[model samples]
Target: MKINLFPLLFTIALFYSCINNQSNKNDLTPKPYKVSKNFIPINKAPRIEYNTFNNITQNQYSFTNTTSNQEVSILHHLDETGFHFYQGLKFKDNNLGVIVGGTRLRARITLNGGKNWKEVSFSRFANSFQSVDFSGNNIFIVGASNYIYKSEDFGKNWSVFDTKYFFKENQSRYQKFKYYKVRFLTEKIGFIIGEHERHSVILKTIDRGETWKIIKNNNLPKNEKGISDIAIISADELIITTLSGKCYKSIDGGVNWQLLYSGENTTLSSIAFFNSRTGFIGGSNNVLMYTNDSGKTWKKIHMPYGEISDIVIHENNAFITTSFQALDEAKSFIFKIDSKGTNTPLPFLTKKDDSVFFEANSYAIQTLNNHIYILDKNNLYRTIIN
Candidate 1:
């Protein structure tokens, strides 16, 4: 009788173990992701035709030009001490553009499409400039130590607004306010996102750049540290990406915010919307996400590079710049993403010497009239997008 009981109990235990094993195996199986019908799946997207310019040397200026072929040609170079780095670039049209940067507060303007650049001088208030934006004849530049430079006559005369008073009434607090990006929705309405003591700060200007006020109830997440970029859909709607990989949307002009996407703890450096309902966000760790339904949902797009520095969308194509440091060397790339979610890599300027000036870590790209203008370190390059 004892022997009979033992055999039966052993049999029952063995059967249950087999069932559990099968269940665990089923749990490990990969499941397919559900994508919206409006969005194209990556595997099913169409491939775009493009060319890469890999052989252009640092000293050698221009690449081979063709209608269908993309060319990377150096337009201008800044070898002076104060103009060794370029932080921001904005083109007013096909013929006029401005670039701002620093070893000290420095900017260069080209009226003939980067053929010639003239130095723009600033008062010795801020040591560096980070970003620039323009609407019509009015140009706004933001930079370190709470400096906001406004030029109503297209960089002819400068009016500086030191926003330290808007933050805290102290000198130390003024130094802590660093403006990273400036965006103007219209000639009169604009937003600036930066940092105050390592926390994200947003400043709003309803009267162009004449005056600014801090957006107090921005409703940013408690853990959000710094803001990487801001995208304005309209005067009332705005989106911002944080250094913590969180994206927030404000429908009521940044008075209140709603969390749209919480990323995988990576730094989202750039965001661009081709339209109100479709956009792309790029970040560290080769993270590139595309959302068709605004920011309600996002899908990962495979990127071959590590940090995405900037994203510019032109004519239904998204151009992305990414850079990564490798063994004391920096490598950069330019990728074109089409409406169908296809990604094509374009050629970028390679380092010809052991100099850091040619390293493409913080380069910027802008497209106008079928030409792509790139600001790389102290040099400016142009490429035709065919």
Candidate 2:
């Protein structure tokens, strides 16, 4: 869900904020100006080159070919600093990720998919980066504290969003906790769920991230256990699962929720919806549960024998990422399915080990602009789903 930002947090300790509202709209979309200068696209593959600025030679942007492979380009480096303080990456027309500043304590933001970067004092003195998400061309970046910042025009300018309107936590979990996952269904509507009892929070923004409202702890079946993840079905329906195998469907956004699927002892980590009645849930021990009659009842499907971390449904396509090894493979995997949980792992990117830690093991996946994006550590990579 997020990469460690400890190194970057130290780097950007002295750095402060940028322009408050909006300024760098120009920095994100440098197209129509120049081709070979502002931005570059990986055709066959992008040549791996060392960045002298930071003296790092890691794969900044990777596009697989014959020798390379068929997996979409997965971003590996963000700061180019020997210290990898990569937080998360976002893919629009261009890809953007965060880097840590070495001179002062500040995190640098990179665009054009890590080819270039700009320093932004976004994460200052943060213990860890909880989670990051993109909405309304605005970047909502959160860390170990109650801090949350929004970037306008890609990563050029940023503004802080006061999360106190919808959040109230006095325990150390709120002060020292980190976010595990974030999701944005619409620019103005979405949710972010994380760890800790009270930290298993849910937020909704009708006016983008300009403001937030907490819908957790509301009148529900039970809201004690930590939430694993959430998937939006519609304006009135959203499917959420907890680590206790408690699966709930919210017919009124998140205001009121009801149980759709449960097994008493199933630790469901991920859930996705096709329309309203059709959905799937993934949990511990390679378990996959499906509901065809709109959450009325569910039956388990034998998925790949492994720890299924997350699942995504688009039309008839279901993309799943495996966390643990099936047996002793130990390496992470990606599988695609149609309607049912039966899926074939994409052979192109399945290697012994990837450049980044979890390129093959990542759990953060977002679809935008007709492309599926995955965030492994601080790098963000994308591909046109074919």
The lDDT of model 2 is: 0.56
Misplaced by over 4 Å in model 2 are: 1-71, 78-89, 96-109, 117-126, 162-178, 195-199, 221-223, 264-266, 325-332, 342-348, 351-360, 376-381
Q: Please provide the root mean square deviation of candidate 1 (C-alpha atoms, Å).
A: 21.3
lDDT of 2 at 188: 80
Candidate closest to the true structure, highest TM-score: 1
lDDT of each: 0.70, 0.56
Q: What is the lDDT of residue 232 in candidate 1?
A: 87
| Model 1 bad stretches (over 4 Å) | 1-60, 65-68, 79-83, 121-127, 169-174, 326-332, 342-358
Q: What's the lDDT for residue 9 in model 1? A: 93
Cα error, candidate 2, residue 362 (Å)? 1.7
Tell me how far the alpha carbon of residue 68 in candidate 1 is from the true structure, in angstroms, after superposition. 4.7
**Models, CA RMSD each:** 21.3, 15.9
